[model samples]
Target chain A: MFEGYTLAELGSIFAMQGFAGLILFSVFVLMALGLAIIFGQMGVINMAHGEFMILGAYITYFTSNFFLNYLPALFSVYFFVAMILAFVGAGALGMLVEWGMIRHLYRRPLDTLLATWGLSLMLQQFYRSVFGAREVGVELPQWLIGSLPVTDVIEVPINGLFVMALTLLITVAVAVLMYRSRWGKQVRAVMQNRVMAGAVGIDTEKVDRYTFGIGCGIAGVAGSAFTMVGSTGPTSGQLYIVDTFLVVVFGGAQSLLGTIASAFVISQAQSTMEFFLSGSMAKVLTLLAVVGILMLRPQGLFVLKVRR
Target chain B: MRSGNIFLKRNEVVFVVILSALLLVVFPMALDSFRLNLVGKYLTYAFVALGLVLCWGNAGILSLGQGIFFGLGGYGMAMFLKLEASSPEHTAIQSTPGIPDFMDWNQITELPAFWLPFHSLTLTIVAILVVPAVFAWIIGVAMFKRRVGGVYFAIITQAIAAILTILIVGQQGYTGGINGITDLRTLKGWDIRTDFAKEVLYFVNVALLLGCLLLAQFVRRSKYGRILVAIRDKEDRVRFSGYDVSNFKIFIFCFASVLAAIGGAMFTLQVGFMSPSFVGIVPSIEMVIYCAVGGRLSLFGAVYGTLFVNYAKTIFSESFPELWLFAMGALFIGVVMAFPNGLAGLWQAYAQPWFDRIGQRGAPRPISPAPISPTAAPAERRT
Candidate 1:
């Protein structure tokens, strides 16, 4: 495949596609973080997780439109406001779903998958009806658009770089919140042993709800960042849901670090193969490899040293 | 336990008879050929639903990838039909006169080795059943042997479905692409497109469905069925009691896949085309909803469930396309939340009591092991 290209050209090609994979990695990590927390901790398969992300995407859309229409001078910084609103909007909805449907089906993990699938269908239809079926692309701020040329052959898109930086910031914040914060300890305590956490005077149920909200909130931020590179549609979320789930499952569902690592591995492999093969074939091979590995190591890439 | 273990007690026989009458006599007499063909297609899904009744409802193995097997069988039949339709005489104008048109378009001058066996009717029939069975066996062995069950199994199977769909859609030349294996003209020189052939195919579909229903009944009523239920309820206990839990799980999953495959094959014969649309994640999950709506426990209810949901889908999606998603979404939520046991559960609760009170007081209780609620987790609960 590389026979035609000079060594320098091949190097640049790898670098460019490798960067593309990093952007995909950021998306996967952002999408799977919430899912890993909800699925691993609660053992509830939230099939509507993608829908929740789409909710964030839609919020970002309206925020951008508002800024474009009413605040022309402030358009450059509108994404910051959109990110906050998307987080709050998606988080609030996640909490409501947790309180309503998911709260009822915790015991049956399988049933949760079905119910949330129902939830996903309703949400998708709602989006389709509210927003026309056509995919809507966000108009990027001038500062966020364009590309930086590292060399004559290798150019990197500014929006991709921005999304990557944003992913790094959020991932670090999530890591710190999960590991170093007092509340994070409480959440972990509850996940580790509900009865013990309750016995210790921790409000376990409240912790559970908040943990779910935070997970979903992260997904919303992911979607906010996604507006930079991809167009949003009612069903775009469905396109990534399977891939996101694979990242979470293959990474070791409960391990945040595992999720990131797996996402990086999968995204990189997919992008590299996609350069050589047709996009669909590349995706099939990537997923097939993941599934094959998962069957062999059902516990996933990282198994937390928990007694259970 | 033995006394309660019989297959289709007296009144249950009457139930099956009436159901058969509806499919065999009443539907044919009333509906036109086109509508009857549509019904026949829906009945194919009933094969899948009945398999779910045994595997999912009875044994507690929820596979989200039934569509893989369904597609495998569908493509198997489709391959044969495409070959027969693309004979040298019919395709004399093309560069590759004998091979499928898709292959010719893809610039392949020769037929692939894999498509050769599809030329024989016997081989096609064998492939229809064995292809899915073999694939299911592989998945079943790999997952079950490792004690992978529940949500993990479902997700893995779902991934397989996605991979297969992508493969089919991507490798257009080999598998007929997104349009799928189309322009299917005949089956063993009989014009399947004709109305008379359509009626004949519908009867064959119904007969195969009933045969599958009986096979499922046999599995449900035998000792293996009891073991399967035990494994579902108390898997560890069953393992401790010296039964091979994985073997039972594998068997049921493979059995379900085979049933789904047979449905897929019949669907190709009746519908005259096989497409990737039917074998993807969306359609696969939709198939599960069919089983869910029919009361996952009752075989007879499964058939009705498949027909009712598809019929509503056709009508609503055709008339008010937008409302169909909402309606379908509501159906999934409603089936899971309000009636986990489905239509059969409703019948067992309200209608059956009235029947029992009116006349069945002196008769033996007519019930299957499934319709009655089991000591399992209720579908919904609040902490």
Candidate 2:
């Protein structure tokens, strides 16, 4: 496939595709990060994770509209406000769903998947009703609007860079929150031994709710970041759900670092393949590889060295 | 489960008789050919749902990729119908005269090697069965042999469905692309589009479904079915008892795949086309939900679940399109959370006892076991 390209063209191709891959990597990382928490840690499959992300997208969409209409002066910084609002909105909804739906099905993880799927359908219909069925995009602030010319043929979009940077910061924050913070410790403790954690003075129920909330909150942020790259639609989130689940599961579901690593590998492979083959073919191949690898290594790329 | 007199205990025989009558006579007599054809279309899904009862409800193996087999069988049948429809006289305008129109539209002058075997009707039918069985066998062996049960197996199967859909849609020239093998006109000179033909086809679909129901009932009643329930509830216990657990899982999964394949093939015949839309994660999971709604444990319930849910879907999407998802989503959550046993469970708990009371005066009713969470020690196993 590369045989037709000149040396300079090949360099530019790899560089450009690699950059594109990096943006994809960021999206996968963010989506898989939230999924790893709820699904991997809690043992609850939230099939509606994608819809929760779309909720964040809608929140971002509405925030942009509010800032545009009512606070034009602050519109340049609206994304920051929108990100926070997306977090709160998505997190609150997450907590409510966890309380109303997920909590009952904790003993049945597969049932949680089905129920959340139902929630996802309702959310999608709600989005369709509220936002209209068409995909919508947010107006980028001036600072995030353009691209940086790296070379004559290799240019990187500034919004792509911004999303990647945001992903990095959030990834670090999540790592710190998961590994370094007290709440993270409590969440981990509960995940390891729910009864023991409760016995040790952890509010396991509250932890479960918060953990689910925060995980969904991150998906909101992912959706917010997504508005920069692609238009948001009622069905947009669903397109990524299977891929994101694959990323989390193939990463060895319980490990955050594994999620990151799996996302990077998949995104890079997919993007590079996109340049060589058609986009759908690339997706098929990448997913086939992931499924194939999973068959061989069902625990995935990483394991926590723990017994169930 | 009782170890003797396994064809059907008294109640099951009554259930089968009632179901067969409804499927064979009641539905046909109640509606026009068009509605009957639609019911036939829905019955195809019942095939998938019935298989789900054994695999997911009975054996605790939840496959989210039943669509793959369904689509494979549909596509295989569609391919043969397509070739027959795309005769040299019919497709004379295309660059390629003898091939299906989609291939010609994509500028392929010759048939793909893989699609050649499908030109034969006998081969296509065999492919419809064998292909999915082989595919399911491989997948079931890989995942179950590795002890990858639960959500992991579900996700992997879903990924396979996604991959297959992408492949089907991407390679449009070969697999008819996303629009699918459309404009299927006949089945080897038999005009399938006519109302009389449709009525005949409806009976064929019902016959196959009843046959499948009987087979599923036999399995459910057998000692093998007992082992499946045992595996579902206490997999480790069954493993320690020296039965090859993976083999059982693989066999059952293959059986489910074959059933789904038949459904898919029937679906194509009834609906006139098959597309990648039915071969994705969404449709696959929706099929599971159909079984879940029907009473995942009840084969009789599986048919009604497919009929009523699809009937609702057809009606709702026609009237209030937006509310359909809400209804569907609620069904999923409600089924899993509130009524895991579905309509069958409801029938057993409330309706059956009431009917029995009406049937006999002052007779002591058989006490039905209350519903228990699948995780809890089984207060009532279905037998």
Candidate 3:
């Protein structure tokens, strides 16, 4: 169809595709980070992680509504406040679940999968009951609702840029938290050797709670950010959970770098395929590729050095 | 001692005979049409649960993707039924010709190449079993051989289910998309709407369930079952003991896939429809929960678990629809935390005292504790 396209046109098409990929990669990273922490670090098969993100998206929706009605002048700043609130909201719920249910079943990872899965279904239904089943459009703030012109022939959406930046910022912050902070060290210690960490006076329970909260909080952030690009509904989280898990598993459970790399690879593949084919086919192809790759390297792209 | 042995033998023989009689004769008369249909569905789920017992419960491998196999079998059957319904003779009588409604809507002129073989019942049945087995065998060999275990294995399996669902849903022209293959017509000229057909399907499902359960029982008592259990408990230890752990896992996984396929086939037969929703990650997770709640260690537990939980779902959905999910969540949490042994475990525990009391002096006691197998830890943990 494009056989007669000039080199310049082809170059522009490639550039646009890369830009689209970068936006998708950011979303993928945001989605996977929370899951990696929950499943990879804590060994809790948190089927409710996606629901936590939806909670954030709903919080963002409410914040936008409040801003439009009561504080129209501060609409642009609503996202920041909403993001913080979402983090707290989802984090609090995560802590409650941890203390109430997940904490009791740590030894039984498989059981935890079912428990969390049931929790997810309940949450989804609860959202449906409260918000109605239809998708809710969160009005984008005026300042963030346009495109940024990269060239005469090519343009990128400002929201995509925001997501990319936010993803990078979050990734860097998470890296710092994991590597530089004492709490991060404790989390790693607990993950590596829980009994040894406890012997050294690390509060493994507290670590578990905090780690879970952080993971859920990130999910909330991802959800809130997703309001810019996707539909917000009762079951919206279901759409991303599989993709998020794919990234986490394909990346290698314990490696953040692997998550980032896999996100880039998967998103790029998905975006490029999407440009050529339809959306659903692209997803299928990407999944098939992931399954094919995982078949080759069952441990994933990056293997953790921790002894089982 | 002789009397005791005789009593034990009598109890085992009588138990089977009574159960068979109940299944063959009593159940049909005791239950109403709706209840019979519900039981039939449960029996189908029991088949899936039995497969899970082999893969997750017995093999120590938590396969979160049995739904894929189940869905493949389901879609396979649905495809055949759809083809049968769309035969040239039936199409001439109907308003639309050749293609199904969705295909007509989507402007598909010809049947997809892959779906052509489904017109033959023999080919369809073969495909139903072979497709899932082939898929599982390939995936299982890749994963088990590569030494993937624990959460990693679970996640990958789940990914497979998710990906498969998406693929099926995306191919709107061929696979009926997200709406799934629904509103199926008569199966092999049997009127699906008639009570007689439903009854026939119920009996067929019961037979399949009993046959599969017996086969599972045999497998469980076999040496391969012993090795599978060993691999589950300690793969490294088993490997050092000169056993091929991966091969055992693959074998059980393939077996489980076939069982899931049979369940799927029966499910499609009873329901007379199939959809992508039936084969996704959520349903796959539900399969695991079924085994967990029923008592993953016991074959009877798998059957019991499917019946009890699905019955609970029906009751809750009808009575307190809004709170159904909440109730399910609470039940799952409660079961995992308190009654980890599940309903089967509870039955065994409660039955033991009664069995002991009924036993006379010098009479052999039934319900002897079987030797603990390695893969039986999950079941034992529940107890």
Model 1 TM-score? 0.96
**lDDT value, residue A106 of candidate 2:** 84
Interface RMSD values for the candidates, listed in order? 2.5, 2.9, 2.6
Off by over 4 Å in 2: B1-5, B359-383
TM-score of each: 0.96, 0.97, 0.92
Model 1, retained fraction of real contacts?
A: 0.64
Candidate 3, CAPRI quality class derived from DockQ: medium
Q: Which digits, one per residue and each the tens of the lDDT, describe model 3 over residues B1-383? A: 36543222344444446556777788899998878887887778788899888777777788899999999888899888887777777666444577666676677877778988988899999999899999998988888899887777888888889888888788887889998887777878876757888898999888888888878777876788878877777778899999888888888898899999999988888888889988988888888788878877767778778888898889988898988878877777777787776776776667744765666444675555432332234344321
Model 2, position B76: C-alpha lDDT score? 91
What lDDT score is found at residue B305 in candidate 1?
Answer: 91
Error of 1 at B34 (Å): 1.2
Considering only N, C-alpha and C atoms within 3 Å, which residue pairs clash in candidate 3?
Answer: B4-B363, B4-B364, B229-B375, B340-B382, B341-B382
Q: Write the per-residue lDDT of candidate 2 for residues A1-308, one digit (tens) a residue.
A: 87888999988998999999999999899899999999888999989999989999989999999999999999999999999999999999999999999998888777888889999999999999988999999998899988899888989999999999999999999999999999999999999988989999999999999999999999999999999898999999999999999999999999998999999999999999999999999998899999999999999999998755
| Ranking of all predicted structures according to lDDT, beginning with the best and ending with the worst | 2, 1, 3
Pull out the clashing pairs in model 1. none
Worst 10 residues of 1 chain A by lDDT: A100-109
Badly placed stretches (over 4 Å) of model 1 are B1-5, B361-383
Q: By the DockQ metric, which is better: model 1 or model 2?
A: 2
Worst 10 residues of 3 chain B by lDDT: B374-383
